[model samples]
Target chain A: EPEVTQTPSHQVTQMGQEVILRCVPISNHLYFYWYRQILGQKVEFLVSFYNNEISEKSEIFDDQFSVERPDGSNFTLKIRSTKLEDSAMYFCASSEEVGRNQPQHFGDGTRLSIL
Target chain B: GESVGLHLPTLSVQEGDNSIINCAYSNSASDYFIWYKQESGKGPQFIIDIRSNMDKRQGQRVTVLLNKTVKHLSLQIAATQPGDSAVYFCAENRLTGNQFYFGTGTSLTVIP
Candidate 1:
């Protein structure tokens, strides 16, 4: 089956540096999302995108965080001035359409480590 | 903020026994629920989902039961196998928003 794919399975960056996590959602998917899971913690929603605009975001998605669909297939999350707390597993998910019945499919995830 | 939680943190079942994982949500407005399984180094994989209008839904060897009144959800696996051992999570979505809130996961270990 077609699935979401993420690049740079593991990322290590300095505390003050900028990091961009990339994802290629299913080709036919119209809605994309970003979520993070701290070690041994529940998954937290960061943002959702549709029609090249943000549909919704959580408080955890602050000024330092931004998402972009630079092209037809790529969805990226950029975090500027990363901190130690920013280290976590970032996952990209997508669904063919938005509805009560459509379930989001997730990628394996990119492990982000801040030094 | 709304939250979803599991009833137990861990469960163990025999190789051929049936396993049931339970979850509870604090949001009364949640209209959709999903169950996901995650291995040690992987992201959550969708297993099954149910709408508030339905009390039960089944797929393959898995069954999902939803109780709208009590805000409860459960996933049942028939004849659990070693591959079925993983961390299970429950997620809920409210009609007013597109975001899904995930719950604490339950770790299931299958003793073969």
Candidate 2:
């Protein structure tokens, strides 16, 4: 099955550093999303991108967070000036199309640890 | 106001037995629901999904039942195995938005 792929299974950075997480969605997918899971907590939606624009975002997706589809296949999440609270597991997901019934597939996730 | 949560935090079942996990949603507009499984170090894996139009949908060894009136969803795994031991989460998506709100996740342990 075609799956979403994320780079750097784990990353460590300083609190004030900038970090960019990369994802390669399924070739045929049209909608992509970014989510985060704090340790032992529920998954939180960060943003969703479609047609090269941000379709939706959450309050957690503030000025520090931004998403980009620089090319046809690569989707990226950039966090400028990461805070200690930013330490969490970031997951990239995608679906073939936008619909109420389409299921979003997920990547293994990147464990971002800010010191 | 799109927060999905599970009723139980953890459940234990014997190998070869059936397991049922339940989730609840407060959003009445949520029209799509999905169940996902996650191991200790992996992302949420899609297991099955049900739309508001359907009350029940079945997949390979799993079945999903949705009750829109009560805003409740349940995932049933038949003949559960050790591999089925993981955290299960239910996500709800509404017609008003494309974002999916995930549940708190229920951890299942299969005793082999």
Best model per DockQ: 2
Give the residue spans of candidate 1 off by over 4 A.
A99-101, B1-7
lDDT for each residue of candidate 1 in A29-115, tens digit (9 for 90 to 100): 999999999998999999999999999999999999999999999999999889999999999999998654579999999999999
Q: Which digits, one per residue and each the tens of the lDDT, describe model 2 over residues B1-112?
A: 0113465588998898898888988799898999999998888999998989899999999999998888999899999999999999999988768778898988999999
Worst 10 residues of 1 chain B by lDDT: B1-10
Cα lDDT of candidate 2 equals 0.90
* Candidate 1: residue pairs that collide: none
DockQ of 1: 0.70
Alpha-carbon deviation at B112 in model 2, angstroms = 0.5
lDDT, candidate 1, B7-100, per-residue tens:
5688988899898888988799998889999998898999999989899999989999998889889899999999999999999998767778
Per-candidate TM equals 0.96, 0.95
